[model samples]
Target chain A: MPHLTLEYTANLGLDADAALLALNHALAGSGLFEEADIKSRAVPLHSFRSGTAATPRAFAHARLALMPGRDAASKRHLADALLAALSAQVSSPGLETQLCVELQEIEADCYAKEYRHG
Target chain B: MPHLTLEYTANLGLDADAALLALNHALAGSGLFEEADIKSRAVPLHSFRSGTAATPRAFAHARLALMPGRDAASKRHLADALLAALSAQVSSPGLETQLCVELQEIEADCYAKEYRHG
Candidate 1:
């Protein structure tokens, strides 16, 4: 399973849900994962600090959690696509924005889940 | 830098900020990374879907963005501790809750950032 978390700063003029949708679409288009298999969400970062800059700072970083199996090139392509999608959707006029994408390998054996219904 | 993002369902009876603080404290206590170096945040999920259950379902999932270097045992220990910390913090009486922790490796070479002031 691949879970995508897109974190965009509040200062950045970007719609989180819209960006998630677009990025998810782009990822699905990569022919790696099915559209339905991808679970995506947006995290709007409110409180943050960064290096000194003349203008205000903002960022939109996407982290994708992937179960172990994909090769290096496949992941690289996916990450690059996500970054391009973020830059396209999150660019503002005056804010200093940093865009990033990271791929996380989830150890399939160690992963655990249980429903505690109480 | 290791960035921690904790995502808890809206129905979960948890204080987002307090849980973040406690979890960050727990991570720092591990001696793996300094408290100040851990950039932490919480995302309250308003919408989700899960399997059929008699009671309402809720979850608290933590994803840590870690740069590659730590061994398997070290990462496993960190994830287990984080899961325990989450369980201790976010528990409600009636809802079925699932707690999970995921460690993601951020590739050093592929990571890119640009501060754009425009």
Candidate 2:
């Protein structure tokens, strides 16, 4: 299972639910995960400080956790795709926002997942 | 910088703010990140499915993203420490909760960070 998490500053003026949907779509479009196995969520940050003492800015960061063994090129592509999707969906007018996406590999031996549905 | 993210079912009845603090403390205690550079956040999942189609259960998942180069054993230690801290802070009374912690390594060459504080 690949878990994609979006963490954004609350000042962005974007809907968290919409952002989560965009992220899930991006992950699915990347052909990296089954639609049912894709776990996406957005966490809004109300208290955050960014930039220099003179210029405060907003930031959106995404972290994708996938099982290990993906090649570097594939990981890079996933990161770029996710970042682009997030920026398109979350950016607001007249706001300088820094967007970043990091692809992280979850070691299979140390990872555990259990699913229950009712 | 290591970013620790906590994703849990919202029904856990735990204070998200308190859970975040406990996570920050656990990460600092692991001594893998500088106190100033550690980023911790919690996301409460209102809609989630676990186990089979009969037993609806709650789950807490923590993903720790760190810079590449940490050995497997060190990663395991960090995961155990984080899970213990989270379970202690977030578990609900008389609820069946599955707690999982995954350690992920961010590929260094493709990772980027920009900080601005005012």
Candidate 3:
């Protein structure tokens, strides 16, 4: 189960939904996950602070949570793919935007889910 | 840096911000993290699907992202604490609520931030 969450600062003028889809595509293109199983969402951050200075900053952070089992190398590969998509999505000329992608292993034993169809 | 996010269903009878504060308190009480450095937020899900049946379901899932170095026991302790607080906060009569707490380690090298004070 790959649950992708993209949290971006409000100052960043990027379409959060589009950015999420792009990142989802990047994950899907990696051949490591199924497009249908990836649950993606975006959160637009309005109030946030980073570092020790008020020199104006923005960021887009994405966290991908997946079922535990992937090797370290494969995890890094997924992280790389997502970071690139997030970086490109929030790229701005005059704004110093920090982008990060983190991977978390969801415990298969503790995780539960169900699918309902109409 | 420890970033915490609590995602829950909107139908749950709970104050998002209040629940976030309680969770923050739980994490702070763990004595494994600094209260000031804890960045926590909540996302209320208006539209979501959980299981195969439409019998109504609710959940409160929290993720804690911290700098790597904690042991398994310590991590479990933190998760347990948060889960307890979350369960107590989201308890309702005749409603099935799923609760989960996952811990993630933040790579210090990849994380960037700035803080400004008045």
Candidate 4:
């Protein structure tokens, strides 16, 4: 029940190669995690801006299958650390940033490889 | 904890308008569900077959935020029904298909509307 997925507007000054590298580093620096069970993906959100549609927004989505035994205290601590790492890496004060973290608590039987023929 | 995300190769016969309509209808026929919390998305996967890499595969991804109160028995019943509906809609017996369902169990503090700037 500790899997987490993070979805945010893309291209928000956070997609640059340099910024992404820094973010990955921050994630690795956190000793509470391992990438063995974590998988993250960044999806692009683009739309047209005509007249009164306000400014455009970008988002990124990260899906993480957290390791087992993550308690309430540990989750909060990890979340705060992640946000801090992201903030330090992004460094864009003018853009409106949004971070949404969802902790997936339940899981059923899932196979790493497709058992179609078997 | 019943949120389910289904991902498969795209461009299968199920992508046809008629097939999708039938699938949605079948989902609605199940009295244990509501569209308010169920959200599904389909992404296409296409690649060229130039050598002995075998035939092409199509997949679909459905993300369903299931309504609460789905117990073990209820989930099994629902999964069977959903699979039956999909099979009935996609009648291509020759096509190799795969069905993977995951139950999302845990959720943390999540706001439908971003509480940014507040």
| Candidate 2 chain A minimal-lDDT segment of 10 residues | A109-118
Top TM-score: which candidate number?
A: 2
B43-69: candidate 4 lDDT, tens digit per residue? 334552324656644434444454356
lDDT by candidate, in order shown: 0.77, 0.75, 0.75, 0.44
Q: Model 1 over residues A3-62: C-alpha lDDT tens digits?
A: 988877778788777898899898899998977779899877874533222346566778
Q: Give me the candidate number with maximum DockQ.
A: 1
Best by lDDT: 1
Between candidates 1 and 4, the DockQ winner: 1
Per-candidate DockQ values are: 0.18, 0.17, 0.09, 0.09
Q: Candidate 3: which stretches are off by over 4 Å?
A: B1-64, B70-118
lDDT score, candidate 1: 0.77
Q: Write the per-residue lDDT of candidate 2 for residues A15-118, one digit (tens) a residue.
A: 77677777777777878676666665577788898865756578899888788887888888888888888888875667677899998676786665543332
Among incorrect, acceptable, medium and high, the docking class of model 4 is incorrect
Which lDDT tens digits does candidate 1 get at residues B58-115? 8878998878999999999999888888888896778777899999877774454544
Residue-level lDDT for B80 in candidate 3: 92
Candidate 2 RMSD to the real structure: 7.1
Q: Give the lDDT of residue A33 in candidate 4.
A: 56
User: Which structure is stronger by DockQ: 1 or 2?
Assistant: 1
Q: Give the range where candidate 2 chain B is weakest over 10 consecutive residues by summed lDDT.
A: B47-56
